[model samples]
Target: MGLDFSVVPEYAHFLWIGVVWTTVLTVSAALLAFFGGILFAMIVLYAPRLLAWPTRFFVWLFMGTPLLLQLYLIYFGLSQVGIDVPALVAGIVGLGLHFAVYNADVIRAGIVAVDPGQNEGARSLGLSRAQSFRYVIIPQAVRSVTPPLGNNLIALLKDSALVSVLGVAELVHASQLAISETYRPFEFYITAAALYYLLNLLLEAGLRAVERKVEATR
Candidate 1:
């Protein structure tokens, strides 16, 4: 059958709302994942064996599981256990935890890539281990990891579509709703894909600008 895009203009506003929620979910989850990743990286790198083992296990658990299952557990399973969670909240947490595991590895690799001599120099300056890591190691590590983190941000943005299953009203969810009403899946889904592409393009541009700035400052 020939494609019909006539339904697009009428539902543009609905799609726009979806875009907003998608952006919100991506940003919220990305921030949470980034910080959580840093924490996990620190735990694995510096925490005692007692702490590190459990932290490693936590990372393994999330990394080992499918994000869909994680989302289901958080949103649906929790309710089953008498702890109800709002769809958006559950989505954010699920995305955050899933990405955090990967981010932790990126962060840890960044930290490991730094020269050991840098840490020694910081210590020679009478900086404690924590102080040295905070002031010297983390700054350099962050620089090294920025590109990977930017890529993860893009991935997170794409993954936010998965939250549709939880009915968070994000882009794909909105598209599905429109399809149900109009029975024009092609138009709605194509529009949704275009919106996602545009968003990723904008995000890539922004990340490139930031990367250039980081490079210029170095």
Candidate 2:
């Protein structure tokens, strides 16, 4: 039938629940990713060679793997080892961990983008390397990285849907459930797509604002 509204009057309610869970997952994962990325980038930049290389390797491994596979490993694979991480935790951690690798690389490049002249100038003024980095280099690098960082956060928001496989009840999963129960796939899916578009629109607008603030500081 054409646009079967009566077939699934409850679809809106189910989708609302999905939207809430999706928002929760997206926000939680973004926070973890941001902090983990900063930590990983710092280690890659400043740690001893031995420590740095291994940390770099870890970043590389996570970045190279598919987020879906990582989620499976954390959710199902861990259970095989008796680790039993909660699905919500696994989803957020998996998404955040994956995003952190890419974010770390972006942040590292931002740090490198800072001029050698700035470091040398600070040295000439008798600032130690650590002092120069803290007082001079990092703040500038962080500002430079903000735009790419926001982009990664948007990616994180969309990718959070992958966690649905673990039964995390996010937006996609909710839509799927509604489709099965009501047999109105087109309508439910179109609604889900609209919700995602709205989410992304809000995210992009917010990022643009943050990007402007960061740029203004420079």
The top-ranked prediction according to lDDT is 1
- True-vs-predicted CA distance for residue 186, candidate 1, Å: 0.5
TM-score of 1: 0.95
Residue pairs clashing in model 2 are none
Q: How high is the CA lDDT of each candidate model?
A: 0.95, 0.89
State the lDDT of candidate 2 residue by residue for 1-218, as single tens digits.
58966655567788888999999999999988877887899999889999999998999899788999999999999999889999999999999899988888888898899999999999999999989988888778878889889889988888988999999889999999998888888888888889999999999999899888887777
Please provide TM-scores, in order, for all candidate models, with all chains considered together.
0.95, 0.89
Whole-structure CA lDDT of model 1: 0.95
What is the lDDT, from 0 to 100, of the residue 16 in candidate 1?
Answer: 91
Give the per-residue lDDT digits (tens) of candidate 1, residues 1-218. 78989879999888999999999999999999999998999999989999999999999999889999999999999999899999999999999989998999999999999999999999999999999999999889989889999999999999999999999999999999889999999999999999999999999999999999889878
How many steric overlaps does candidate 1 have?
0
